[model samples]
Target chain A: MEAILKVEDINVYYGSIHAIKGVSFEVNEGEIVTLIGANGAGKSTTLNTISGLLHSKTGSVTFMGENLGKIPCHKIVSKGLALVPEGRRVFLQMTVQENLEMGAFTQGGKTLDDDLERVYEQFPRLKERMKQVAGTLSGGEQQMLAMGRALMSHPKLLMLDEPSMGLAPILVEQIFDIIQELHKAGTTILLVEQNAQAALSVADRGYVLETGKVVTTGTGHELLESPAIKKAYLGG
Target chain B: MEFLSYLISGVSLGSVYAIIALGYTMVYGIAKMLNFAHGDIIMVGGYISFCAMSYLGLPGWLATLLAMAVCTVLGIVIEGLAYKPLRSAPSLAVLITAIGVSYFLQNSALLIWKAAPKVYQPVVSGSLTLFGGQLSVPYASVLTMAACLVIMAALTLFISKSKMGKAMRACSEDKGAAQLMGINVNATISTTFAIGSALAAVAGVLLCTSYPTLQPTTGSMPGIKAFTAAVFGGIGSIPGAFLGGLLLGVIEAMAKAYISTNLANSIVFAVLIVVLLVKPAGLLGKYVPEKV
Candidate 1:
């Protein structure tokens, strides 16, 4: 499979503290690749670096054969990589529909109607609350809105940072199902999650991260069955 | 009947304050800075219009347009040179920088125009006789109030319907998420300054026309009053600025008539203190609880 995204030995620092230490990963076309780790294991940091929100101190991030080092964070979305940021940072003052419209900022007005229809079809709850302010939405609904907003850009590779974070078990399962559905629709996904068991269950491949380094890499089934992963992450 | 005249004059003054307050509220909303230099921009606008009409013999409308254009460019330049570099700096640092810019503009105007006050020719002269001349409204006052209403309506529509306006709202709410969504936060901020400065120019023109005094310090008092007005209405709300400006003007006018003129300013400020103590978020501002 063709690699849609390639991260090579990227190092990142926040002030004096090193956050990501020479981490490397790749997501191929038509794959649901997950980076599973505990909190502060550099999952969000790596995704942010890829999205150009944070710059790497060393190494490179290449998306669709383009080096993303010099690209501004705002311009990164136009290149077809979208990050549904952690905490579901939807514009709180904006209406649900306005928030979704902001997601399609890089696109022309031509595709907006059709894109809105598709997003609404995916999350009917968002459509129901389209006129309501986003801050008023429930957590699960906010997550769906964040995801729906990202999809508005027609992203080639969607990177989700802890979409299931803070969600109830049922809502978490629903979000994972949506991830799988999007993957089947032919979009590559790079997911970061603390929910290792659910991540492994839905991921085609998984990379286990510990203390800013990838400790192990395997297929979903392999990671699920591994005694080390089960003890460390899956709660054996 | 006498009280009605005072109220009318107060509304006229309030309209000018409202225009200036719009400048403050908008820049504060998007850039998250008080932009203390905003009042100085009004001074610059007055000087520009004064020069255009007196030296170049331009028509009143043309001079006002020229002032707006110059102020717009100046706003962008000030934001780029003074505020843009301090984007990631602390709010205190930005506020200090704004104050520095304000002093710089005042000194520059002093050197260019000198301290002598210039008498501004009213852009619109004559008065409307109402209730058999017992109530007379100056054309300048009518024009100022009309301009304020039109500007408020236009600005409201622009912010609600325009793509750039939406981007501005997004940036104001969350800059990081806005950047993630491909909205250029910096450009939105610069655009905000441009619009604010242009409005400052209009306010300057209207103010000078009504009051008939033009000096480097002309913008300072009104600027401070309008800032007070913005806070009274809610610093980040557009409609709040309008309501606050009108109310402040009327209160000031009423105090001047009923109370001592020397105490009018004091009463206006006292009202602000009371409002803040009562509401804490201004009249219309939302109280966002800090996330622990």
Candidate 2:
């Protein structure tokens, strides 16, 4: 499989504290790669660094054969990399449709309209609540909206951070099912999750990160059966 | 008839305050800081147009356009020089810099244009009597009110419909998320300041024409009053600024006519204190819930 996105030996610091230290990872063109870690393990930080919200001090992020060094966040988005941020940070003041429209901000009118239709088709709940303010939506709905908004940009790579962070178990299952559906429909994903059990189930490749360093790398099935991972993460 | 005239004057004054308040609300919305220099920009704009009209003998509308152009460029330069570098600094620091810039502007104008008042040509002159010749409204007042409405309506539509408007809204909501959505947050903020300053230029020109005098401190009282209107209406909300300005104008005018003229300022301020005590978020402001 061809690597679509690559992060090699990247280090990120927030003030004096090192957040992501010498981390390296890659996502193949048609794969769901999950990054599993404990609390304060820098899972979200890694995603943020990739999306250009936070700059990395060292190393390179080559996306689709282009080096994304020192590029501003907006310019990075224009290159077809989208991050569905942690906590589902939808524009609370805007309507669901407006939030989706903003996803297509860099695109032309014709592309934007087409992408809006595509987003509505995938998340019909968003369609029903199109005119409703996003902040008023439930947590699960906002997460869907976040994903739908990112999809509006037609990203070649979608990175999701803690998509199931605050939700009922049933909602978590539904979200994972959507992830599976998207993966089957040929979208590359980089998922960061504290929910190890569900994340491993859908991911093709998995990396266990501890304290900002990649500790183990394997196929999803191998990581799921590993005793150490099972004990620390799955509570088996 | 006497009461009707006061109301007419109030509406006209309110319109000026409303346009000025829009600048304050918008700058606060995107930049998250008070552009204290904003009010002074109005004075500078007024002076610029006055010069163009008096010395160069430019037409009325052309002078207004030139003022707007100068103010827009000046706003960009001010933001780039004074505000941009200190963006991540403490809010108090940025605020003090703004005050410093405000004083710098006033002093510069005093030095250059002198403290003496200059006669201003009314953009629209003459008065028309109404309601059996008891109530009369000046054409300048009518023009001021019409310009204010047109601008307010156009801005509201721009924000609600335009892509850049959505980008501005997004930046105000979450800077990081906005950037992640392919929005140049800094650019959005700069555009917000430019628009706000452009409106200030319009407000300045119309305000001077209404009063028919240009002084170094012409914008001081009206600027402060407009700021009060922004706070009264809910600082970041667009319609709040409009409503607050109009209401403040009416309230101030009514107080002057009905109550003691010396006590009008006191009465207007007292109303603000009462409103703030009851609703700390202002009339239309959203109550920001603490996330943590």
Candidate 3:
């Protein structure tokens, strides 16, 4: 399997504070690879760096055989890389349809209707509330809207930062189910989550990050059953 | 009859304020900064139009178009040079920078054109006498009001329907999310400035035509009044700016006629204070509660 994304020894800093210290990871063409860690463990930072929101001081992020270092953050979405940012930052004031339209900002009108149909088919709740203001939607609905919005770009690789965060347990399961559904549909996903159990349950492979470094890498089952991961993340 | 005349003149003045206030509200909406230099842009537009007409012997319509084009370029240049670098800076810092730019433009105009006020030729002359000459409306006032209405409608459609307009709304809501969605936020902001400054040119021309005075300081007082009008109606709302401007104009006119000319400005500001105390978000602005 070809690696769709390759992150090599990237270091990032926020002013003088080094936030990401030499982190590296990869996701294959058709796989759900998750980076699971505690709060402030640099999981979101890694995803942000790949999406071109933050620049790394060292190393490279190669996506589809092209280096993403020079591309601006906005242009990165057109390059088939989309990030569903933390907290499901949907445009609160805009209508649901407008929010989805904004998602396809790079694609113009071609394939827009078909894409909207596809997204609506995937998320029927959004269709029912297509004209509703996004802020009025419940937390779970907003998550789906954010995910659906990213799919509008027809991204080759979808990077979701904490899609399950702040969601109810049942909604978390639903979100993970959608993740698995999209994975089976042949979309490559790079997920960052603090919910270790749920993440590992759906991920084909997982990396355990601690203090900006990958401490363990294995099949999802292996990480799920590992004693250290079980104790530290799985709440053994 | 006298009251009706004052009301008509007031509406005409309000129309000019409304046009200028649109520029303020738009830049404030997207850039989340008060481009205090906006009023000075109006002055620059006035000077540009004045030069094109007097020095170049251009027709009124051609001169207005030329002013709009020049101001559009000037707006983009100003954004690139002055405001773009301060994108991530604190809002207070941006506001101060805007003030600095305002003074710079004013001083530059002073040096270029001198302080002597030049009489501006009316783009439309004569008056329409109504109700057997008891009520008379200047043709310039009619043109100004009509121009303001057309601009307001066109701008409303442009903002609500255009792709760039949607991007501007997105950027105003969340810059990071907008960037992630592949919307070039910088370009959207530049477009906002361009539109706003172009409108400033139209407003400048209308203002000079109605009042017939052109000077470096011409845009300052009206600019300040328009800014107040924006805040009075709701700083970020297009329609709010329109309403606020017209109301402020009527109030000033009524005050000058019924009360005292010296007290007209005072009454206008006092009304704003009262309105703000009643609705802190302005008449049309949404009251977004702070997330604790």
Candidate 4:
């Protein structure tokens, strides 16, 4: 009952293939929940369904106790859910500032600039390159820009899909630090990652996805300590 | 003095083509479809204004506005009915659909108005003398050029400064990413169609004013020319369309004056082929490598 987002027994299909089967999870308010999985384990698919980019074949996605069925992808964002997609699909031709402005497209008035300022403060690197075109930025900078752009919408529930997919080790640490800062600032997050180590380090709870199903779930620490997770994901 | 007159008329003609090309480029930008029917919308606009002023006795300003309104609705309707359903279809199918719509509009206009050329008086009749009559440019030519500039200026500001404009740009960059930001991709696309169609109407009305004749087939040649301009400038680029239109116009005028009128279109197409061979991305278009 206390969960801000509840995914109950959802099944998603891509064409004739079953992409996700009977998957369920809960994200409570003010908690960072991570979904750690190997490639082709349907990690991105699960997040895409929740973000309304992909439709579920069965079951329900309830956000704040409201069913998010048949809602268009854009409407889902206006409902205070933002997805920082994989590959950091920022508008490459636009300047950093313009990309941020697009995040607040649903808003009617003055708050857009204010929201942009808030985002800039959170990601100062974004502030420095506000006028730089997004494509010209490095891979890590583009990832930060993607996260910052999503934050500009003042989303109640933020979803990050593989935020550290291609960053250097140092940059990955910086990215995780920013994520921890966001969590501390009370932003509820649903994180999807193949980098189980960094994801579990900051996550309050974790779910292990394999073959399109949740095989195990626990506190971040418990998953880190588990022998199976250590052998498979943590490279122990 | 004679050279200045030719330059003025060429510019005036080029402005009309630019307006039409703007429609093609804009539709292609947001929807990624060629919108071949766009040129025909200009024909409809010309006929609408012709009917309103000639048949209904409305004033020219009111008639032109009516034409604009009708064309805007028609554009939206075509997008909603014809293009929206095929959003996910392959590019070839959509292209064929656009060509079909173009033919349908042309034939329907023929059935309603016949093929007879209707004489259209320039909105502001007669030529205006400039530089002590050393260059006598028609008022219609001056008006057409001014209108083109105003529209271009307004469009530039809108794309750069407005929220919806920003959304359109975002969609052009990546539709899925734009949707993640809460932009309704379908709605943005519809708005783009509306704007493009309105510009088509402007071009149609102005073209008729300069030439003072309207027929069901009037838009065909100009439509092809404008499309060539779009390709010449770079299909998805705004400034590219403008530059392409102006250059094509000047080239056409030069070919007619110095060479033969029969060779004008050939020269224009030859320039397109040469430019494309030299720079396939168009003059102002950036080479965007597809992200793997």
Candidate 5:
């Protein structure tokens, strides 16, 4: 499989604090890759750097062989990479459908009927509440809306951070189910999650991150069986 | 009969304020900043109208159109140079910069146009009889009301039906996410300022004709009043601002006629305070739930 996104020795800093230190990873086309980490472990920073929200001090980020350095977030999005940022940051004042419509803002006036129908098919709950304001939705619903909004962009690469955060156990299952559905639909996913066991269940490959660096990388089944992963992340 | 004439005057006056309030509300709704220079934009519009009419010898209608055009361009320039640089700065910094811009523009006008007030000639400065009551509405006043109504209608349509309007609203709700959706955040902000400043120009032109006198600092009181109107109506709601302005104008007029004229401002502000205390979000402010 060809690499759709390649991050090589990327260094990102926030003022004096270095967040991502020479992080290197490759997300191949049509694969689900999970990055698991503890808090302040530089998971979000790596995603931010790739999405053009934060500039890297060193190293190169290539999406489909095009360099992503110094590109604005909007322009980066136009190239078919969408980030469903942490905390389900749906536009609260807009309706659920409007939030989805906004996902297509980069598409200009292109046909969105298929994208809209696909999103509705993925999250039926969102379709029922399409007219409701996003801020009024439950935490899990908002998460679904956030994912639904990103999918509306018809992105080639969907990078999600903590989509199950604060979600009910049932809703978390639903979110993960949607992630699997997205992968099956041929969208490449780069997922970041603290729920290592659940993420590893669906992820084809897994990278365990500790303190701003990749500590281990292997096949999902291998990491799931590893004693270190079991002791630190998956409780016996 | 006197009361009826006052009603007409109040409605016309309120409409102008409402137009100005729309600019404030639109920008505040999206940027969550007051754009303090909004009032000065109105002053700039008036000066532009004066120059077009008196200096360039353009007719009244042509001058008004020219004023709107010039002020629109000026608005885009201000956003590009002033507000754009401070986009990521703290809200206070932006607020102070806006105030500074307002003062700078006003002082520049004073220096160039002189401190003396200029009155744009009234296109209709006559009396009309309606329902056995004689009322006088300056042609400028009628024109102002007509212009405001048309603009308000157009803006309402744009916001409700246009793609750019939806983008603006979405950006207002969540700028970061809007950018992720491929919306040009900078361009949206600039467009918001441009539309707002253009509305201010219309108000400026109308006001000069109605009052027949203008000064460099003419926009301050109106600016404050329109800001108050924006707050009184929900800050983010276009229709709310218009309603609030009309309500404020009528209340002020009634207080002046029936109550004490000196107490009009106090009464209006007191009403605003009472409304805010009851509902901090204003009349049309919707409740948004925070993350649990």
Candidate 6:
């Protein structure tokens, strides 16, 4: 598989505190890669760094073959990288349809109508409540809108942070199912989650990040059986 | 008949206020900064119009257009020089810088244009009585109302239907998410400021036609009044600001005629306070619950 995104020995700092320290990872085309970690493991920080929300102090973030180190967040997105940020940051003031339309803000060359249709097809509930304000949507609905919105950008690499963070167990199952559908539909994914067990279940490959460092990388099944993973994350 | 005339005057003046309020609301919406220099930009417009009409001896109509163009460019420059650099600064820092810019522009105008109020002599010196009552509607009033309505309509269409408008709305709603979607946040914000300031210039020109006297501090009353309109209509809602301005104008005018002119300002504020207490989000604003 060809690597779509490569983060090589990148370090990110928030003032004096080192948020992501010397982290390295790669996501191949058409693969779902999960980053699993406990709270404050710098999983989100790494994702943010990749999405250009935070600049790296050292090393490089190469998308395809081009260096994305100096690119602004909007330009990074135009290069086909989309981040569905944590806590479902939908435009609360806008309607569901408007939120989806905004997703195609970077579609400089493509027609948005096709993308809008695709998003509607993927999330029928959003289509039903297209005129309703995003903030009024339920938690699960908002998560779906967030994913649909990212999909509207036609991203080569889709990064999600804590998609199931505040979801009910049933909604979590549904969200994971949607993730599986998205993966099957040929969208490359980089997922960060605190739900290690569930994340490891669907991920083709997994990275265990502890305090901003990648501690382990393996096939999902392989990581699920590891004793360190079981004792700490998968409830023994 | 007397009350009707006040209503007419208020509507005309209110429309101008609404246009000016747009600049404030748009900048606040996208950048979350007040752009306190907004008022000074209006003052600059008045001065520019004064130059074109008085200095260059152009007609009022042509002078107003030129002033609008100048003020628009001024607004874009202010964004580039003052607001853009401080995009990531604390709100307090940005606000102080805005005030500083406003004061600087006003005082600079005093030095350049002189502190004395310029009497903007209108080309049309006569007023027509309409509706069988002694009503004074200057040709300038018609021009102002028409221009305000056109701009308002155009802006509404742009925001609701245009691609850049969608980007602007997105940026205002969620800057991070909008950026992630490839919206150039800076460009959208700058465009917002430009459009807003241009509208303010138009208001300033028309306002000067009605009053014909503009000083360094001419923007203060309208500035504060438009701010109240922005809040009254819902700060971020484009149409809401227009309605709020009209509401305020009518309220103040009616209060002055029925009650006392001295109490008009207080009455408007009292109404605003009541409206806010009843609906914290302003008349047209919706309450968006934050996720803790």
Return whichever of 1 and 5 wins on lDDT. Answer: 1
Clashing pairs in 5: B124-B139
| Alpha-carbon RMSD of each model | 0.8, 1.1, 1.0, 1.2, 1.8, 1.9
Query: What is the per-residue lDDT of model 4 for residues B201-274, given as tens digits with 9 covering 90 to 100?
Result: 88988999988899988888899999999889999898888989988888888889889999889999999999
TM-score of chain B of 4: 0.98
- Quantify all predictions' global Cα lDDT against the true fold: 0.94, 0.91, 0.93, 0.91, 0.87, 0.88
Can you give the lDDT of residue A4 in candidate 6? Answer: 94
**Tens digit per residue, CA lDDT, model 5, A39-134:** 999999999889987889899999999999968888988898999999988888778888888888777656677888888988899999989988
lDDT of 6 at B10: 81
- List model 2 lDDT by residue over B1-292, tens digit each: 8888889889999999999999999999988999888899899989999999999999888899999999999888899899999989999999999999889888999999999999987667889888778788998889988998999999999999998888899999999999889999888888998999999999999999888888888888888999999999999989999999999999999999999899999999999999999999889998889554
The weakest ten consecutive residues by lDDT in model 5 chain B span B122-131
Q: Each candidate's interface RMSD, rounded to one decimal?
A: 0.5, 0.6, 0.5, 0.6, 1.1, 1.0
- Which model is ahead, 1 or 4, in terms of TM-score? 1
Q: What ranking emerges by lDDT with the best candidate at the front?
A: 1, 3, 2, 4, 6, 5
- Index of the highest-DockQ prediction: 1
Please write out the lDDT profile of model 4 over residues A1-236, one tens digit for every residue: 27999998888888888989999999999999999999988999998999898999889999998899778888998888899999999999999999988887777757977888898898888899999989899999999999998988888899999999988999999999999999888889999999999999899999999989999999999999999999999999
Chain A alone, TM-score for each of the models?
A: 0.99, 0.98, 0.99, 0.98, 0.97, 0.98
* lDDT of candidate 5 at residue A187, scale 0 to 100: 96
Residues A1-236, model 1: lDDT tens digits: 88889999999999988898989989998999999989889999999999999999889999989999889999999999999999889988899999999999999889999999999999999999999999899999999999999999999999999999899999999999999999999889999999988888989999988788988999989999999999988888
For candidate 3 chain B, the 10 contiguous residues with the lowest summed lDDT are B283-292
Residue range B1-292, candidate 1, lDDT tens digits:
8999999999999999999999999999999999999998998989899889888999899999999999999999999999999999999999999999999999999999999999887678999999998999999999999999999999999898889989999998899999999999999999999999999999988998898889889999999999999999999999999999999999999999999899999999999999999999899988887543
Per model, kept true contacts as a fraction are 0.94, 0.85, 0.90, 0.94, 0.88, 0.98
Best by TM-score: 1
Per-candidate TM-score against the hidden true structure: 0.99, 0.98, 0.99, 0.98, 0.95, 0.95
Worst 10 residues of 4 chain B by lDDT: B121-130
